[model samples]
Target: MSVELSVGKKVSVTVPGSSANLGPGFDTLGLAVGIYDTVEVEVIASGLEVEVFGEGQGELPLDGSHLVVKAIRSGLAAADVHAPGLRVVCHNNIPQSRGLGSSAAAAVAGVAAANGLAGFPLSDAQVVQLSSAFEGHPDNAGASVLGGAVVSWTEVPVDGRTEPQFKAVNIPVHSDIKALALVPSFHVSTEAVRRVLPTDITHLDARFNVSRCAVMTVALQQDPSLLWEGTRDRLHQPYRADVMPVTAEWVNRLRNRGYAAYLSGAGPTIMVLGTEDVAQSLLDEAREQGIRVLPLEVAGPVEVKVLK
Candidate 1:
């Protein structure tokens, strides 16, 4: 039997935004940046109520179909608990559909909120699993759940009828490393960008990406200098360039100047990971071309609090 949450019980959740692919790691690697979205969930006596502010104010749905609401219900089910009604308020700072993992962050905020309301019944791994299921891949979701950097993977059930298992392990990013995001004004659908990728690639390219993925893991932990080489890739990004010409142009521009820049997620946002800042003049030039520059530090895991 599900335990009923008390009316007036409230929980607040803060989850960070993330960047995935980080070049060669493809769907395997992700990093949580300082950008955040905060959601507050309160159990009430009657019907559901949701309020949105900041980033997704007018556009996002305010009903049960909302990703956050769905995730809350999923979390409550997993915890064997129920809320008679909920009041959810979201304060979003992450840019939507700009390769910044806004969707994953929302999912994390919802799951984390549910877990908090349930008196912390879910483990970190369970939280990761529930939140990641929303994305069909764990990279972005895992980073938001576990924070810092994460290496994640999925487990397929032998029966093929059961849901795939999502798992992630946190990685300690080198302290000196920072993230620089060059965000474009327009939104790009993750699905639309993914459709442009070819169905197959040569063994040589596969081998090349594997080596770079290995390099990236080491660079993120031990040697910041290896970042430039580690971020090199022959997969997804190349196929995506034509679709996001401005993002592609800026990525090439920053990389040519020796910064380790890559397309963030399924992007229109280009992300740079490095120990030092990119030159101001170049940043100014990107701004002149209408790109929004955000410099952020690596962030910690999602934080949740049961409110009085």
Candidate 2:
């Protein structure tokens, strides 16, 4: 049996943006950044309504087809609760399609909102699973749900008919670690960037990434100095350099100068993970080239509050 949420019920959810593939742990490591998106949802009497503000205000859909709305429906269904209607308002700070996990943040916010409206029926793991299913991978969604840094993986069902199970564990990030993103003006499609990767890779390259992934875990937890070596990869970044030349150039430049920089997700954004800020000259140079630089701290998990 389904329970109907009261018409006046309202909840507010704030979820942080994420940076995924944090170097060699491609599709496995993610970090939640300080940038956030906040969504307010209310159960109403009759129909669906949506309002988007800030980053994607004019371009994003204001209807049920919106990603946030879909996620809310998914969450409500999972909780066996129904809302007669919904009003969703999004105040977005995360840049859309900029490899900053804006979509993942939306999914997290919506699901979190639904859980709050339902008296918190879902567990943290359940929220991570539901949010990650929208992305087919747990990296971004997992970070937004669990916060700080996360190591995540997916389990495929043997029958291939059931949805893959998404799981993640929060890993403590060293206090000195900080993130700086050099965001390009143009948007890069994650799917398009992914399609460019080869169908297969050499075992030697795989081994290199595996070692770095391990190093990254250690570096994130205890040793910030190892960040340079930890962030090195022989897998995706090399191949992706061609399509995003400017981002490739900046990453190379920073790395050559002894900074740990890499492509952020399927990105035009080059992210630097280090204990201190990038040199001002480099930031100025990037700005002159129209790249927006954002200095961010590691963020906490998504937060939800019941307003009514």
Candidate 3:
């Protein structure tokens, strides 16, 4: 399909923040939460421009250096479509590098904006594939684009003729499950956390994680009662403790309290999956300990609102 973008067309896309790795799933499972970052784009007469508000106000770049614009350029280039001069506005809430899929949301917002302006040429899977190129992985971007809970994986074609492939599928999660994020004051860089991990692990350790992840998928759909056992991991978090001691500390603390807690994707945020009663007890304890946490339910599907 080929369609030219008119100079005056405008579009807005809202993408949700995601918490990935969900313990043993490791770069494959992600759950979209209520937090969001929105991008509003409009065709203009000249060069790119952006305005930012809320989170990342001073620290995030607002010019062509902005992540949103770069994503849009990437998407347009992938489509072999030329986008006209555009104005992009970002109203952000997802904290960058907080294990909340902020970068994925920005990447998707930009691509979605470009697709909308170009008269919607790319499919959602195509959008995810291009956005994943910017993210270096598909887990977070897949959840952001597909919404709800999802499993994403990469496949490198054995045949040299085809490029590497990304596949994402929405998964069913019982409604009784809820997620609470026990956030910290500081941010942990994804690279920093990854750098701290050991390159190898014992075979037994690998088996333990694989077992839990396998159970976790069925448990989330069939019965959430097993979450306490399902969210266990031995892969990265143990080694990453040195980078963010608080996250490691709380995982032990909350688990000891009988709550299923795990690092929220290279995080300083601990994701607690439980029922409402468990959530209440968590809040009570958090209040007493002076910890900050956000109660989040699974997010709805990603949306594009085009204003004609």
Clashes of 3: 0
Give per-candidate clash totals. Answer: 0, 0, 0
The C-alpha TM-scores of every prediction are: 0.99, 0.99, 0.93
TM-score, cand. 3: 0.93
State in Å the error of residue 115, model 3.
1.6
Candidate 3 ranges beyond 4 A from true positions = 1-4, 158-163, 278-291
lDDT of 2: 0.95
List all candidate RMSDs to the true structure.
0.6, 0.7, 2.1
Candidate 2 on 121-189: residue-level lDDT in tens? Answer: 999999999999998999999999999999999999999799899999999999999999999999999
Candidate 3 lDDT? 0.84
Model 1 clash pairs? none
Runs in model 1 deviating more than 4 A are: none
lDDT of every model, 2 decimals: 0.95, 0.95, 0.84
Residue 149 miss distance in model 2 (angstroms): 0.5
Please provide, for model 1 over 1-308, each residue's C-alpha lDDT reduced to its tens digit, 9 standing for 90 to 100. 99999999999999999999999988899999999999999999979999999998999999999999999999999999999999999999999999999999999999999999999999999999999999899999999999999999999999979999999999899999999999999999999999999999999999999999999999999999999999999999999999999999989998999999999999999999999989999999989988999999999999999894
